[model samples]
Target chain A: MLTAQSTKQFKFINIDRVALIAAAAGLLSTFAAGFVTFKPNRIAAGEAFSLAASVPLQGFLAFLALWILVALLSISGIRLEKQAVFTSICGGSLLLLTFFLAGQYATAATLEHGSISRISPGTGMWIMVFAEVVLLLNAVQRGGERTRFVTALSAATVAGFVFLLLTGHLNDISIMKEYFNRQDRFFSEFKVHLLLATSSVGAATLLGIPLGILALKKKSLDAPTFFTLNILQTIPSLALFGILIPLLAYLSARYSLIREIGVQGIGWAPAVTALTLYSILPIARNTYAGFATVDPGALDAGLGMGMTRTQLLMKVEIPIASPVILNGIRIALVQAIGLTAVAALIGAGGFGVFIFQGLGQAAVDLILLGAIPTILLAVAADGITNWCIAVIQPRGIR
Target chain B: MIELVNVTKEYPGTVAVKDLTFEVGDGEFCVLIGPSGCGKSTTLRMINRLIEATSGTLLIDGTDIRDYRPEELRRKIGYAIQSVGLFPHMTVAQNISVVPGLLKWETSRIDKRVGELLDLFGLDPSAYKGKYPRELSGGEAQRVGVARALAADPSILLMDEPFGALDPITRESLQNEFSRIQRGLKKTIVFVTHDIDEAIRLAARILIMREGELVQYDTPENILTSPGDKFVLEFIGTDRALKRLARLPVQGLMRSALSVVLSDDPGKVEKSLAENSYLWVTDNEGRLKGWLDRKVLDKAPFNMEDSIVRIRVADFAVSPDSTAKEALSKMVLAGTSSAPVVDNTDLLVGEIRLADLLEA
Candidate 1:
C-alpha cells in the first residue's frame, strides 16, 4: 500500500518530468491551434487571420501563463512546486528569450504580422526561474527525508534567478503583433523550410556515420577520404550553391530524371541538398573523435577475451564512444539549420522565402515572417538535441 | 593439470617472457610472482592465449591448449585480472552469470548458479544481485570477480593479483577466506602477484620470474629457506625470518606459563603450582583475567579463588594466528618477557617467549 506522502512524491517526482508533461501538453495545444480554423471578426487576411490569430495567441498565452505561474511560485519560495515550475520557468524562459530575440529581428524586418514569438516564453522560463528548487528536490531525494523543505525551496528560488533577464513582453512582444499582421502570407512557407532543413540534417547524419566507421577501420582509406571531406568543408557555401545550380540544371535537362525525384529549383530539394552539404563536418569529425577516444587497454581486454573484431566494435567501442559521436552530430545539426535558412535566398522553399520576398518587396513584416521561425526553429532544434544527448548518454558515464 | 614447456614471448625491443617451463599439478595451488616488468603477467596471459607465446608447447589436461579455439579455451579456463574487469553495465548477478550464460545454460540454471556463487562468496544474492559494479566496495567487487570466474566451475582457475588493490587488513582476511574456498573446491589454480608475501602464503608451488625468465620455482618454505640466486634472495630481503613466521601456525609459539588469580577473593593462596610460577586467572569459562602476583604467596597465604585484580587486559596473551612480529611487538610494548596463547574457546594452548619468537 502506498502512503499519501509517497503518492505526493510520485506526483511531484522530478521537475523535468513535470516540465516535460507541461511542455508536451503545451506543444500539443500549439499543434491543435495550427490545425483548427478560427474566426476573428474585422481582421485583414480575414479567413486566414481568423484561422491563425486568436488560436495561436490563446494557446501561446496558456503556455505563457503556466510558465508565469511557475516563475512566481519559484520567486515566492514554494519548494514543493519548484522543480516543475523552476525547470519550466528556467528552461522554458531561456527558450522563450531565445525565441523573443530571434522574433525581434524577424518582426523588425516584417517577416511576420504579429508577436507569436513574444507570446509564450515557454517552459524554459519556468525551468530557469526555479532551477534551484529542482536541484534542491534532487538533493533531498538523494540526501534523505531529514532535509528541510525550506532549504530546497530557497535553493530552487536562487537557481531560477541565475539566468535572470529583467525584460519580458515589454518592447518586442508589442511589436510582434504589428510585425505578423504585415507579413500574413509567409507563415505557411516558413513551416516547409523547417521540415526540409531538419530532414536534410538527418539525411546527412545517415550518410556520414558509416563513412566515418570505414575511415576509422581502414587506414589506407583514412587520409584520402579525410582530405576530400576537408576540401568539401573548405568550399564556401555560396560557391557550393553556385556550383550545384549548374549541376542540377544539367541533370534536370540532360536526364529528365530529376523532376520525378522532386528536384525542383525554388523548392525543398535544392534547400535540402545545400543544408545537407553544410552538415557533414560535425558528424564525420565527431565519429572520428568517438572512435579515437576508446581506450586501447579496454579494447585489448575485449580482444583478449576472444571477442571478434566486429563484436568488439559493436559491444565495446561503439557503446563507449556514442556520446562523442552524438555531440558531433548535434553540432552538425545546428550548423545545418542555420545554413538551410540561407537557402531561401536562392528561392529554395523555407522561412527564407519570406525574408527573400520581403527584401524584394521592401516589406519588413514579410521578412519577419520567415526570419522569426528560423530562429525559433534553431532554438527548438538545439533544446531538443541537447535533451536527446542527455537521454542518450549512458547513465553509467555520469 | 596445466603444463608450459619452453615458453618465450619476444616483443619489438625486448623479450617479455623467455623459456619458461613449469607444470601445475591436478588441484594444485600454483602461484607465479615477481616484481613489475618481470613477465609474470605476460606468462599468465599466454596460458589463456591472450598473448601468443613466441615458442612453447602448452598443455591443459595433457592436451595442447593452442589446438582449441581461443574463445573455447577461455570458456573452459576461468580467468580473472588484477583490475577485476566486471562489465560496468551489468548487475552483480549478471556479471557473475556471464561465463555460465555464455555456456548457454538455461536461465533458471544460470540464476541458480549465480545465487550459489554469490552465497559462496558471502554476498547475499537477494541484497546484491541487482547492484551495479560501481555500487560495490573495492573488496566486494573483487570478491564478485572471483565468484564470476568460478561460475562455470572450470577446473583450471587463473587469478592475476586479485587482492592487489585492497588495504592490508582486507587483503589478509580475503586471502584467508579465498584460501579456505580453494581448499574446499580444490581447483587447479595459478595465481599471479607482485607481492612476495602473498605468493608465499597462497602458493603450493611458487614460481618467481625475472625479466621474462623463470628465476625460481619451488615450495614457499624451500624458496624462503634457500633462495635460488642473488635476485631471489634479494627479493625476499632481510624479511626472510618474518616471512617464515607466516607459514607457522599460532600453536607453534604461544606462551604456556600463565599465572592465575581469583576474581572475587583478592588474598588467598591454595592454587595449583607445580613448575608454573604464574597462572592466567579467569572469571568464568576461561575468559582472561590478569595474572596473580607470584610473590604475593611469600607475603601472605593468599588464595586466588575469588578475588582477581586485572592490571591490564593487554598483560595477558591471545590466539595462535597472531604473528610473531605482532607478539614480539606486544611483548616489547607491554614490557613482558612472556605471553599466554589461547584458542577461540579461550583454552590455554601454550606460551610465547622472547626466546621462542627469536627462534621462530
Candidate 2:
C-alpha cells in the first residue's frame, strides 16, 4: 500500500497484539450471548443450550483469510502491510459474520419454548466467561498504557455487563432471582427496549447536522428552526404523545407512507418522535459552533496550498472542528436517553417501564432494576463515545 | 524574476503600499525591510495573491499575478512566514512533503524528497520523520518551514520574518546558513524583515519601505552611504556606519607599509621605529604583527611581537567605497587613532585618521 511507511510508524507494539485479539474475542462472545438469550424460544422455553457453538468455526475461518492475505503480500514483496486498515476490515467482517450467525441461531432456539431449568451455565456460558477474562486481561494490560484505551474498556465492560443482564444470565441465576421477583421491579424482564429510543437519537443526528450546516450558511433559517425545537421540548412528553396520537393516526390512515416508515401507533412512534425532537437542539447548536470554530488562517493556508473548497472543508475545517461536533453528539445522546424513559407513557417500553411498573406497585426493587441500568447505559454510552472521539482527535490541534 | 509595477494598496484610512515598482532579477536575493506597518508584509503577501492589489500589477517572471488562481499562484511561489504555521498534527516528514503531496508526486519520491530536505536542514531524516511539530525546538521548526516551502522547488521564494521568532544567535546562524544555501540554488528571493541589520546581512539589494511607500531600493553599501532622504537615513539609522563596516572585508583596511619584525631580533623594532613616531610592525612573512611605539626603544628589549599592540586586521578595516561615517565607527570600535585601509588584496593602502573621517 502507498501508506506502507506511515503504517510502519504507527505499528502496534508487539505486546498490543494480544490485547487486540482479546478485545475481538470479548466483542464476539458478547454478541453471541445477546443472540442466544434474546431468542424467543430460549426466553419462553428456558432451555440450556450453547449460544455460540458456531463462533469458533467462524473465528478460525476469519483468521485463515487474514493469514492468507498477509502471506500473499509478504511473498510478493509488495510491502503493503497497512495494519490499521487490515485489522479494521478483518475484525469488522468477523464481527458482522458472528452477528449474522447469532441471529440465525437465536431464531432457531426461540422457535421451541422450554422450561426455565433447561437454561444452565453450559459450554456457551464458559466460553463467554473465558472470552471476558481475556478481554479483561487485555484491557487491564494494554488499556492501562493509554487514557483512551482505559476509558473505552471501562465503558465497554459496563455496557457489556448491562447487555448480559438484559439478555438472561443475571436474572436467571438464583442469587439475583429475589430481586427479580419483586412486583414493582422495574427491570424484572431482560427486555432492552432502549434501542428504539436510541435509534431516534441517531436519526436526529443525521437530520440535525445538515440542518445546522444550512442554518450556518443561511442565518435567516436559524430563528425559526430554534423556535420549533424549543416548542417541541417545552411540551410535556406525555402531553406530546397524547397530542401526537390523534394527528398520527389520522396521518397514518391517510398516508400509507407514514406507517411504512415505522411511525405506527402512539407507542414507539410518539416516543421516538419526542426523543428525536429533544435531540435536535444540542446537535444543531454544536454543528453551528463547530463550523464557526474553523480557523480562518488554516482555511487560508489550505487555499494557499491549492486545496479546493471541498477539500478544505473536508480535510481542514472539519477535522479542526470535530471536537465540537463530537461534544454536540454527546449532549444529544445523553439528553435523548433521558427523554426516552419518558416514552414509556405511550407503551414505548424503555427503562421507563421499570419507573412506571415500580410506581404502580410501590416496589423499590423493581424501580432499582429499571432505573439503575438506564442511568448506567447513558453513562456508559457517554464515556465510550467520548473515548472514541478522543482517540480520533486531530494530532496538531490545540 | 518578479516585478511589481506601480502597485498600490489602499485601505479606508491609509495606503498600505503605494506606487511600489521594482524588478527582482532571476536568482537575485532582494529583501524588503522597514519598521512594522511599513507595508513590506503587504507587498510580500500580494506576490502570492494573499492580498489583492488595490491597483497596479504584480508580475512573476513577466506574467501578471491576477492571471492565475490564488492557490495555483501560491503553489508556484514558495512562502515562509514568521509563525512557521506548520500543521501541528502532521509529522516532520509530512509537513515537509505537503506541497509535493498536493502535486501528487509518487510516495517513494516524496519520501526521498522529505529525507533529503531533513538532511539539507541538518536534521536526521530517520529521527525526525514521524515526530510532530510539538517535539521540535523553535529553530528546528523554522528550518522545517523553510524546507516545506521549498518542497516543490518553486522558482521564486517569498519569506516574511521567517526567523523572527528565534533567538538572536539562532536567527543569525540560520541567516548565514540560508545565505550559503541560496548562493548555490540561486532562486529569486523576496525576504521581508523589520531588522535593518538582517536586511544588510542577507540582501544583495535592500528595499527600504516606510508608511506604505518605498523609501530606497539599493545595495546595502549604497543605501548606507547615500540615503534617498532624511527618512531613509533615519530608517537605516545612526548605526549605518558600523553596519556598513561589517559588510567590508578586513583585507581592505590593514596598513601595507610595515616594518618586518623577526622573532630572533627582539630589539630591531625600536630601531626601525626610531625615525617614525610609531612603526607598523609585521612578522617575518610580512603579515601584520602589531603597532610599536617609539618609547619602546628605552624599555627592556621586548620582542616586537610580544609588546606590539596587535589588532585583528580583519576587524580593523572598512571598504574603500564605505561612507566616512562607517570608517569612523570602525576606528572608534577598533580603538585605533587611524585606519590602515587596504584594497581587497590585503595590500595596505593609506591611513585615514579620526579627524579626517570626522571632517568628511
Candidate 3:
C-alpha cells in the first residue's frame, strides 16, 4: 500500500507563487515610481524623486537589502511552514523598515528643500504599502500560530511608529506637521469616531439579535425582516444620513426631552442612528443563518435530553452558532468604522473633518492624516473580532 | 409500566398514528416493528411527548404522562435515536452526564455513573471519557449514545431505530451488547425499528404495525408462529425459523459434553471414545483441546500417548455468547455435528450439537 507519508516529497521553499509575484511587483515599483514628492508650497505641483534619491543612502540600502532578503527567502531551500513565527516577524520587520524609510525620506526632503516645502509619500510608497498588506494577509492565511504572530507583529509595529512620533523623530513629515497643528482637535475627533462606531454596533446588536431569533421562530417574519434590513443597507450612507437629519430635527424641535438629550439633527445622534440602521443587515442576517444551520440532530438530542427551549437556545444553539454570528458582527463593525468617517459631514466631529478640509485645499498629507488612521481602525476592528470568533467557537466544529 | 390509550396523532392532512393502544409491562423489552411511516416512531415520540398525540392518554406507572411538564417527563425517560446524536462539542463523559447534570446529580456521582456506563458498554472508561463524538467510530458513538441515555438510571428507555445506521456486522454486535445491557438493567424499554430480524432478536414482545394501525402484538415466538394478519405474516418474511434461531444463544442449547483430561492414559481415552464414537479432550483448566474419533484412533499406527492429545483448531469451538445460528453455521463449515462452547477466557463450558439445536 502506498501510504500518504511514503508518497509525500519534501519541498524547499514553501512560499506561494502569488506572494512571490506580488513581492516582485512591489520591488519593481520602488525602482520605477517616485518614492516621495516635494512641493515648495501646499498648492504647488511637486517634484517626484526615486526611492534612492529621496532617502539617505543608508536607509535606501537597508530597504534594498530587506527586499533582496525577502526575495531570497521566497526561493531558498528553507521551509517556513513550521517556522511561521519567524516568517511573520521577518515580514513585519520588513514592513516597518519600509515605513521608517518613507518617513525619513519625507523629513530629509523637507529639511533639504527648506521649511516651506511639504513632502508626501509618492506612488512607490503606496505600492510598498499594498505589498506589505498582501504579505501580512499571506501570513494570516497560514492560520493558528501564524495569525497570532502576524497580529502581535502588527501591534508592535504600530507601537514603534507611535513611539517615534511622540519622540519628535517624525515631526518633519507633512502628515505629522498637520497632526501637531491640531493636536487637541485630532484627539477629540478620534474619540468621537470611536464613540460613533461602537454605539451604533452596540445598538445594532441589541435590536438585531432578537429580530433574528424572532425570524427563526416565526418563519413568516424572516423574509420581511431581512428585506427591511437589506433595504436599509442598500441606501447610500450619505442619503441615509440625509434622511435621519430632518427626521431627528423635527423630533427634537417637537420634544424638549429629545433636545435636552442632545438628539440634534446634525450631530453624533443622527450619525450613530444612520450607522445602526446600516449595521442591522449583516448582524441580523448572519444570526438567522447561523441559527438555521445548526445541526438538526444535535438540536433534537438537546431537546430529547430535556433541555427547555430557552436552555437549548442558550446552551446548544447559541454556542454552536457563535462563530458565524461573531463573523457577522465583525463585518458590521468594520463597515461601521469606515462609514463613521463620513459622519463628519454632519458635524459629528471625527477624522473626516481633516479629510474634507484636505480635499478642499488639495492637501494630500492632510487627507492621509485622517485616512490612514481610519483604515487602521477598520483593520484593527476586523482582526479583534476575528480573534473573538476563534476564541468563543466550540471545538470540533472548526 | 407504560400504557397508551387510544392515542392518535394527526398532522395537517394525515393521521400519523391512529387509535393506537398498547401496554408495556415493567422490565419488558417491547419492540415496535413496521414498514416506514407505519407510526412506530411516532408512537415512540408521543410517549416522550416529543410529538403530542391529537387525542389520547399516555400513562407511566398509572399516572398520566401529560400531567407532568414535557421537559420533566423527558428527563425521567431515556431516549436514543438512529443518528446517536452525541453532542459533537462535548466529550463522551459530558454527553453521558447531560441528564444526570440536569437532574442535579453531584459532580462525583455523575463522574462515577459515566465511568460505570462506559464499562457496561465495553468501552474503557479512561480511554473514551474525554473523546469527542467525531473521534469515535460509528459503533463506539452508538455505544456512547446508549450509555448517555442510561446515565441517569431512568426506569424507562425509548429507542428509535437505534442501530439502524450501523453496518450488518456492527449491528449484530451492538444488538448482542444491547441485549446484555437490557438484561442487566431491566428498564421498561419501548424500541422502534423497521428490521423484523432486529425486532425478533431483541424484543421480548413485538408489536407489528401497518399503516398507522396495530397488526400484531405478541412474544417473538408467537409472532413468528401465529402472525395476527397477512400484513404481519408477510412482514415477518419466509425465514422465520432462521430468525428464531438468531434469538436463541448457544448457551441455551448447549449440553455438558463427555470429556477426558488431555493427560488421560491413551488406552483409556481410546476405550472411552470407542463407547461414545467421539470424546472431547480438555486441559487441566477445562479449556477444550480437541476431539478424538474412535474409528480414526482404531485405524491409527499412532503412538497411544502422542495421539491422546490433539490441538483444537479455531473453527472447532464457538463462544457460549454467540447465537445458535452462528454456531450452526460454524458447525456446517467445520463439517461437525457438535462443537465445544467456550467462554470469554476460552475455558470450555459445554458442547452444542446440530441435532440438539434443531430439536430446540
Candidate 4:
C-alpha cells in the first residue's frame, strides 16, 4: 500500500524519451558537425561552417526560436497525445527550416564570394534531418497515425517545398545548379526511372498476386514457386544483368521476333525484367501470408452464409487481406526505387547517370544532385503507402 | 423440416459420424447434444453443406439437399456458431445485411430490416448499427451474430453453441433472451450444445447422441425422468430433478408481492404486514431497497427508513425471468421460503416461494 501511494505521487515524472532524444541529437550535431560547406570551385575541398557562422542574424535567431519551442514542448507536462502531435508538427517545421536556412546561407555566400563558388549541405544538416525524421516517426508511432491532421501537415510541407523552389530561394545551392544545367535531360531521365520502376512492379503485381493465391491453394506448387523466385533474388544485380545480356543477345540475334520486340542484350528489357523478379517475392509472400492468416472462423462463417467461392474471396477474404498485400507492395516499391539506380549500370538512363558522372569526376555536389532526389522519392512513396494502408484498415481491428 | 437418412462423415480413416438418421419437425427447437467427438457440430455443418456427408439422403422442406446449388441452399438457411463469426471489417448493420444483400433486397428494405433486427436484440439501432464486430462485448457480438442469422428471415436457423463462449451469467441471460426470441420467431432451429441444462432450458425436443449414433430423441420431461442408457444418465448428471426445475420459470410460480414504498403512509406497512410478517420495502422506482420486519417495526418510529433491514438483491432476490431452480438456490442462501422477484434492473415485481415452486 505504501509503495502504491509513493508510486502514484511519482507518476508526475513520466518523461517523453522521443522528444528528448530528438532535441539531444539536434544539439549534439549542431556543435560536432558544421551546417554547410562553402566551396571555391565545383571539385575543391570546401570549408565547413558551424550553425552560428553558417547563417546571418535572422536565420540564426529563427533556429534558436524553433529550438526553444522544441525545448519547451519537451519539458512541459502536457498530455502525451497532444504532446506527440505538437512535437511531430515542430519536427516537420524544423526539417523545412533547416533546408531553407542552408539555402539562405548558400545565396549569401555566393554573393560574398563569386558566382563560381558553390555551397552544399554539410553533415550537421543531414543529422538535423535525421533527428527530425526520428521525431516525426516517434510521434506517428505514439499518437498521430491515421488522423487527417497528419495528412494535412504532409500536404502543407509539400506545398512549402514547391513555394521554396518557385521563389528561387534554393537556386544558389550547388545541387540545384547541377539540376538547372541539365534540366531537360533530368526531366526525361526522371520519367524513364519512374516508368521502369512502375512497369516492373505493376507487372509483378499482376503475376505475383495470382501466384501467391495459387501457392496458398495448390500446396504442391508452393515450394518450387518460392524456390525459383528465391534463386532469382539471390543472384547479384550486376551478375543477373550480365547473365541476361548474353542470353538476350543470343536470343535476339537468332530470332527476328525477339529483335522486333526490342529484347536487347542491355538496356530496359533486362533492367525491368530484373526489377520485376526482385519485386515478386515481397508481393507474393505478403499476399500468401495475408490470405493464409485470415481467421478460420470468418471463412467458415462466409461459407455457411451460402456465398459462392468467388463471392467469398471477393467480398470477405480480399478486404481482410488488403492491408497486408499493400504493405508488401510498399516494400517492393521502395526497394524498386533504390534498385532502379543500379539499373543505370547496364546503360539504363536514370539519376544514376549523374551519379556515375559525378563519381568519374570526383564531384560530391553532382552526386548529391542524383542521390538526394532518389532518397526523397523513396521517403515519399513510404509515406503515401503508409497513409493508404491506414485509410484502408478498419478502425476496430487496427 | 430437415431429414437426414444414414448420414455419415468419414475422414481418411475415422468415421466422424455414423449412420445418423433423424427428422426434425417444422418449427421445432431440436438440440443435438453429447460429449466432444459426438459429431454434433459436423451434423449441424452438413445441414448447411459446410461439410459434405459421405452418403445420405438429406431432405429440407421435402426436397433433396443436392438438388440446389450448395451456395444457393445455404443462403436460404441462417447459420451461427460459438465464435459468432462476425466479419470484423463490417459494421453490425452490414454484417446483418450480408445475406439480404446477396439476395438483392432493395436498399431501403434492407436498412429497415437491419434496424428492426438490431432493435429486436435490445441494442439501440443507431448506437450499435455502425459499430464493428471487434467493438462489441462477447454477449453483444453473439446477439449481433443471431441478429445477422435472422436478417434474411429464413425458415430455419442452425446454431452451434452460439452462447457457449460467454461467462456463466452472460450465457444464462443470453439463453433466456434466445428462448424469448425463438418463441416469437417460431423458426425451425437445430441447436448443438454439450450443456444438458442449456438443452433442457431452450430445446422443445432433445436428440441425445453417443459415439455419433442416436441414443434417444424425446421431450425434456421424458429425458429427465427416463434415460436411454447409463451413458445418457451420466451425461445429464445425477441431479435430474434439480435440472428439471430449470424448465420452470420463476414468473409462473410468483404471487402478487406484498411490497410497500418507503415513503408511503406509516399505517400501510402494518396493514401490509398483517397478510405477511415479512414486508418488502421499495423506493419510488419500484426498486427493492430492503425489507421490514413487522414485529421489529411495530415498536420503532415509522419514519425511520434507514433503520429498515437492508436486503441486497444479489444475496436475497431472484430475477422474474430466472428459472425456479435459480430462485430456489437464492432462497436457500437467504434462508427464506419466499423471495422477492426483480426485473433485469432489479425493480421488485413479485414474489416466489419454495412451497409454490415445489408444488409446481
Candidate 5:
C-alpha cells in the first residue's frame, strides 16, 4: 500500500521528462540499429551488426540491466540529487560498456580479416553515445555542485579512456588505428589549432574591450561601431579567410614590413587575421552592454565623491562589469575554436587537416579522429570560462 | 563659509537655475526646499562643482571655487544622495573608507575612521563592517551612505534628499538619528528636498525656490509664522499652526516635575497629590520610577509601596528634545492630560501638559 501510494505521487511530483525521452530513444536505437559496422577496407560500404552478433552473452545482459536501471531512475520517486547521481553513473557506465563491446568485436575481426579492415561505430552506436552524453550533461547541469561535479566526471572519463588505450583494448578500433598512424602529425596539428584560436581571441579581446568602452563613452560611435563589426561577422569564416589571402599576399609582396611579420597568402597569417576579425564583434558588443548596464546613480555618486574618470573606470566600473565582460570573451573563444578547424584548408595545420583529408579519401574513421576532439575541446573551453564567470561575479548581483 | 554670487545654470532649451545668490555660514544646517524642478538640487550641486554654474563667482573661505581643481574641490566637500549609491561589490567598511582612501589617508587612520563612522550610525562594527551593500536594509544602507560622506570629515556636505527613498517608519527614525548627529558635527550642509516636514525637522535656515529663483529664505520658525509671499504661504500647508507648535521643542515648554524619591515621606507625597492629583515617583538618582493618584490614597494612611503604581518609563515619559506634537500625541494615546519629560537616560527632569501644547 505504501509503495502504491508513493508511486502515485510521481504524476504530481516534478517528472524527469527529458530523461524519459532520451532513455526511450536509447532503448529504441539499441534494438533497431546496428551496434557496429564492419568494412573489409577503409573506403568500402560496411556491414551492420546488432547486439546478438558477437557481444558476449553475459556482457550483453549487464548492459541491458544497467540501461533499464538508468531508465527506472529517471522515473522513480527519489530525491533529486540521488536521481542525478545514479542516472549519471549508470549513463557513464553504459557509454563505456558500449564502446568496450565495439572494441572487443573490432579486435576479433581485425585478427581474422587482416589489419587493413576497418570497424567504425554504426548509426545505433552513435545514437546511443548521443543519448548517454545528453543524460550526463543534463544531470551535471541540474546539480548544485555543477563545476566540481563536471570536473570530476570529465577527469574520470578521461582516465577510463586512457586506461583502455594503454592496455591495447581499443587499439583495433578504426579511429584508434588512424590515430596511431598519424600520431606525431596529429599532435602538431592539435597544437596549431589551439594556438591559432587562442592567439586570435587574445588579440580580439585586447582591442575589443577598448572599442566597447569607446562606444559606451561616445553615443555617436555606437551605431557606426556595431555596424562595422556586424558586417565583419556576417562574412562567413571561409569567405573571410579567402578574402584575407589575396589582400595579405598583396600587402606582404609590396611591403618588407608586412613580409618581415611573416604575413602570407595561405598560412597562419591569413587564418589569424580572419579569426581575430571574426572574434571582435561579440567581445565589443558585450563589453558595451556590460558597461551600459552599470547603474547611472552609481556613476553620479562616484563622480560626486571626487573620483577622476580613470579612477571611476578602474575602481567602480570594471569590478562591477567584469562578469559580463568575461562572458563576451567566452563567446569569442568558443567561436574561434570552431573556426580554427577551417584554417587547415589554407595550409595552417590543425585537427581540420584530418577532416579535409578524410573527406578527400572518403574515410569515415579518419574524419571521426579529427572531429571528436575538436568538439570536446570546445566543450572544455566553454566550461572553464563559465566557471570563471561564476567565481568572479559579485554576491550582490547574485 | 560658502557664498554664491549671481549663479546661473542655463541649458540650451531651458534655464535650470537663474541669478541665484545665497550664503551658507559655517556649521549651518541649511535646507533648500521646493516642488520638483525648482532648481534647488542644481543650486546644491554648484557648491560641490558637480554641476558648474554657467556664470558665477562661488567662494569658499574667501577663495573662488574655480581656483582649485574640480576633483580637489569635490574631495573636500562630502556628498550623498537619495539612492545611497553604495558600491554593491564593496563591504560596508570599504564603502565608508572610499573618500579617505582617495585622500590618501594612512591605512590605520582609515580603518579607525571607518570603525568610528559605523558606530556613529549605530551599525555594530563587527556585525556590519564586512557585509556587502545588498545585505543591508534600506535604512541601514542609508546610514552607511551618510557614514561614507563623513568618513573624511569634510566641513561642507551636499545632500540631495538622502532619506527620500525610505518607508515612513524608517524615514522618521533615520531623520531623528541624523538630526541628533548633525547637532554634534554641525557641518556646513546644503540639503535639497521637496518635503516641507523634513525641512521643518532638520533645517536651521530654509531656502524656498520656485522656477530657478528664490521664493523665500528664513529660519523655520519665521517661515512658518510669517509669509514672504503667497507661494511661501501655500507651500507650508494649511496645518501651519500645528506644524509651528510641532516645531516647538518640549524642553522649552516643560516645567519642573513634581516628584519625590522612592524613600520620601508618604504623608508628604499624599499631600502633594491633593493639590496636583497626580504625583511622580523617582529613585534617588532621579530616574523616573512610578506615579500616584489621589484616588489610590483614598485608603487613610496609605502604604507607600502599595499606592505607588508602577509605570514603565517608555510608556510614561517623553524625551525633552521631542517637539510639542510628539508629547501631545503620547499624552492623547495614553489617555492622560500630562506626561513627564526625561533626558536620554530616562531621568525625570520636567513635565509637559496637553493644555500647554494647545496654547502654544
Candidate 6:
C-alpha cells in the first residue's frame, strides 16, 4: 500500500498518529464515564455524575467549542507543513477549557446543594488532561516556536486558575475545602518542599561538578567514581533515606558539636543529606560525558595557541561542556523535586504531610491536593531548565 | 631562524622522529612534506615545543628552545591547522584578536589589527568581523584561522595542512592568496602538509621526510631538476614538467605587444600589419579594442575614416596575472600562436607567444 507520493505527503503533513489516537480515545471515554462526583460533605465518599447532570449549559457549550476547535486545528495541520504553533495553541486552549469546566461544574454543584455538597473532578476530566498533555508533547517534538507557545499557554492557564481560586468561585470543592482548613500549614509545607529541593541540588552541584572534572582529568578515578555513583543510584529512595537515619544518629551522638548544630537522626538534615547523595549521580555523569565528548580538534588548537591548562579549561572546555552540564542539572532538579515529597516521611515537613494524612483518612481529594502541585512543580522545573540548556548551547554547534 | 640538530622524538612503542637536522633561515617559507606517519607533523610540533624533542637541541633565533617556557615560546609562534580549529563561540574578529587580547594589548590596537588582518586575507572587515565560524564558508573560516595566527605579528608561523580540508579550487585560491601575503610580510613560516604540490607551490625550501627521517631538503627548482633519490623522484610524480610550468607566471615571460591606435593613419597601420601576421588595435587609453589582419587589410579600400580589418580582443586575449600554462592553453583554444595580455583595467600590457611558454 506504500507509494513514494504517499510517503512524501506523509512527511509534509507531519501528523502525530499517537496524539490523534489518544485524543479520540479521550473523547470517547468522556461520554462513557462520569465527568464529576458529588458528595454530601468533605468526609463522605462521592457519587459519580455525568457532565450533563453537573455542568451548566454554558460549560457544556464551551467544552463542545473546544472539541470542535481541536478537530479543526488537527485537520488544518494535515493540510499544511508548519503546524507546530497551531497544534500547541489548540492544546493550550483545551487545557484552559478543561480547568474552566471543572471550576464551573463545582460552582454549579455548590449552587444546587449549598455548603453541604462537595464536588470533585472525575475520570472523564482526568482523561482529557492526559490527552491534552500528549498533544502538547507532540507539538514539542515538532520544535521551533512550539515550546515558547506552550510555555505561554501554561502561564496563562495558571494565572486564570489562580484568579478563579482567589475569587472563591470553586470554594465548594473538597480539595479547596481541605486547603482553606490548613491555609497557613499548606504554604509552610510548600516552602519547605522548595527549600529541600533547591538546597539539595545546590549541594549536589558543588560536590559533583568538581568530582566530574577530576574524573575527566584523571583517568584512573573515572571507573571507581562512576561505579560508586551507579550503586548509589540503584538504591531505592525510601531505603536510602532509612539508611541515612542511623548513620546521622551515630555521627550526632559521636560529636557534641554536631548535636549543637542540630544534626539529628531525623528531620531536614538526614532528608537533605540523602537527597544530595541521590542528586550527585546525574550531575557527575552528565558533566563527565559533556567534557569527554568535546571536539579533540578544539582542545589541540587551544593548547597549540599557547593556552595554559587552566586557561584552556576555563575558555574552551567549560563553555563547550556547559549546556550538557546544565542538562544534567535539570534532571537532578526535577528528580529532587519529586523525592522531597517522600522526604516528608522523615518529618521533613513538606506537602507529603497531606498525602500521608489523606492515606490514613482514605481521602482521595486530600492526596490530590499534595500530588497535583508536585506534578506541576516538576513540570515547571523541567521547562525552565530545558530553556536554559537551549539558550546556553554554543551558537556554532546549534 | 630555526635550527634542529639531531632532534629525536620517541613514543612508548615506536620512534616518531629520529635524529633530524635542518636550519630554516629568517623570513623563509619552509615546508615539511611527507606521507602519513612520516614525522613531518611531529617535527613541526617539536619546533613549537608542543611536542618536546626527546634528545636534541632545537634553537630559535640562536637560543635553545628548551630554555623558554612552552607557553611563552608558543605565544611567539603562531599556529594554524587543517580543520582551522577556530573557536566556534567566538566571532571572526574575536577569534583573530585572541592572542593580542591574551598579551593584554589595548582594545583599539586589537580592533585595528583585526581589521588589518581581515583586509589582508581579502575578507571585507565590516561584512565578516562579527560573523561566527559556523556562518562562514570553509574557505572563509580557513582564512580566519590564518588571520588569527598572524594577529600577534609573530616573526615565526607554523601551519599544519592548513588548506587540506578545502576543495581543490578553494585550496588553489588560498595558496595564491597566501603567496601574495607572504611576499608582503616575509614572516618565517614552517608549513607541514602531505601534499608535494602544495609544498612546491609555497615553500622556499622543501623538507621531504620519510619514516622518522629527513630524505631531502632543497629549493623547489633543485628538487624538481635533481631529486635526491628514487623516493623523492616518485613522490614528486611524473608531471614535473607541467608543475614547473605552473610555477612560472605569464607576467614574467610576457613581451611588449606591437599595437597600433585606431587614430593612426591607415597607411601606417597597414605597413605595421605587413611585418606581423596580425597587429593589435587599441583605444586612446591603451585598452585592446580589436586586431587588424594583414590579409583582410590587403583587400580593403584603406580609407582611414571608413574601412579596416578588425576582430574583437575578446576572441584572443589573456590576463597578465595568469600562469604561463594558462596562457598557453588559452592560445591553443583560440587557435592562435600569440595572444594579447591585459591588466585588471582592461589596458593592453603585453603579448604572450606560444613559443615563449614552450621555452619556459
Top lDDT prediction, candidate number: 5
Highest DockQ: which candidate?
A: 3
TM-score of each: 0.72, 0.65, 0.89, 0.84, 0.86, 0.83
Write one digit per residue (lDDT tens) for candidate 3, span B2-51: 99999999999999999999899999999998999999999999998999
> Which sections of candidate 3 miss by over 4 Å?
A1-12, A16-26, A29-33, A81-93, A99-101, A112-114, A132-154, A227-274, A343-349, B258-312, B345-349
Candidate DockQ scores, in order: 0.23, 0.27, 0.61, 0.56, 0.57, 0.47
Residue by residue across A1-398, what tens digits does model 1's lDDT show?
99898887864323334434444443443334332211121122212111124334554565456545544443343354334334433443434443444334334423343433333222332233234234334434433343455345445444433333233322343223434464454556656666777787788789778778788889898898778888888888777777777777677767767777767544566667777766776787788878876656445544445556786677667876788888877787777767776776666766676677767866444566667677767877887888787877755454
Which scores better on lDDT, 1 or 5?
5
Per-residue CA lDDT of model 4 for A1-398, tens digit only, reads: 57877977875743577787788888766665568888898888889888888867776666667766766777787766677778778887887888788888889989999988989888888888888778777666666454456546655766787888889999999989888988998888888888888898999999889999999999999999999989988998888888888888899899999899998989998889889999999999999998986777777888898888898888888988889999999999999988888898898878777888889899887887778778888888898999899999866567
Chain B superposition TM-score per model: 0.90, 0.77, 0.91, 0.84, 0.89, 0.91
